[model samples]
Target: MSTQVFYFVATLSILFSLMVIFAKNPIHSVLYLILTFFTFTVHYVLLNAQFLAVVNFIVYMGAIMVLFLFVLMLLNLNKDTEPSKSPLIKIVGVIAGGCLIVTLIGSLKAASISSPLILKNPGLGLVENLGKELFGPFLLPFELSSLLLLAAMVGAVLLSKRDEVEA
Candidate 1:
C-alpha cells in the first residue's frame, strides 16, 4: 500500500516536472512547477516530515510561486514575444534530453539496492525534534537562507519596477 502510494506520487511528480519544462506558456509552466512542488510536499508528508512538508508548501508553492507569477505578469511575456527555435536546434535539444535520461536510468540501474530504507527514529521528522536541531546548531545557516530568499525577492521587485523621469 505504501509502495503503491509512493509510486503514484512519484509518477505524478515526474509528469508535473516534465510539464514545467515543456509547457509553451510561462504561466502554464509556473502552474506545473507549483504542482511539482506540491508533489514534493506530499513526498515529505509520506516520509513523516510534516514540518518540512509544511515549510515546502508555504515557502515554495505559496510564496515563491506567487512571486514568480507576479514577475511573469509584470514582464508581460506572451507567445508573440517568444522567439521560435529552429527545427535543427529543437531536434538537437530532444536528442540531448534523451541522452541525459538514458544516462540517468543507467546510473540508477547500477546503484546497489540491497538494503531497504530504514527510519532510524520516527521522531526525527517531528517538528519538535526538527526545531531543536534547527534553532540550536543550524540557526545561523537557517537564518542566512531566509535572508537570502528575502534579498532575492527584493531584487526581483526592484528589477521589475519601472523608473519614472520628470522632464
Candidate 2:
C-alpha cells in the first residue's frame, strides 16, 4: 500500500512538473510548481525522513510560495481589503472568555482552601540527603526524562526557526 501510494504521488509529481513547464500563464506555472513541491514533500514522508519532509514543506511550500506570490504581485496586501470579525465569532469569544474567568476563580478558591506545603521530614528536605535519594534510586528515570526533555526542547527550537527575509 505504501509503495502504491508512492507511485501514485510520483506520477502526480511528474504531471505537475509538466504543467509547470508548459502552462501559458506564469501564475498557473508557479501554482503547478508548488503542487510539484508538495508531492516532493510526500516523497520525503514516504522515505520516513520526517525532519526532511517538514523542512521541505515549510521551506518550499510556505516560504517559497509566498516569495513567488509576491514576485508575481498576485496577493492583495492592503489593510482596507481585510474583512471585519463576525458577530457570532464575537459571541463565541465572549463565552470562551467567561469560561476562562470562571475556571480561574474556581481554581483560586480551591487553592485557598487547600493546605500549604510543609516538609514533614527534616532529613529528606535537606539538599545533601535529597541528592543522595535522587541519585541512589531514581537516577535512571531522572536521567532518561531529562534527556527526553532536552530532545523536545531541541525539536521545538528547530521547528520555530525561520530563514531570514532580506530586503
Tell me the deviation in Å of residue 39 in model 1: 1.0
User: lDDT by residue for model 1 over 1-167, one digit each (tens)?
Assistant: 87899999999999999999899899999999999999999999999999999999999999999999999999989999988899999999999999999999999999986787787888788999999989999999999999999999999998888876621
Model 1 clashing residue pairs (backbone): none
The list of candidate 1 runs beyond 4 A from truth reads 84-106, 143-167
lDDT of each: 0.94, 0.83
What tens digits encode model 2's per-residue C-alpha lDDT throughout 49-131?
A: 56667788999999989799778765643445546899999999999999999999998888756575555664563456657
Give the backbone clash total of model 2.
0
Candidate 2 local lDDT, residue 104: 97
Once fitted onto the true fold, the runs of candidate 2 whose alpha carbons sit more than 4 angstroms away are 74-167
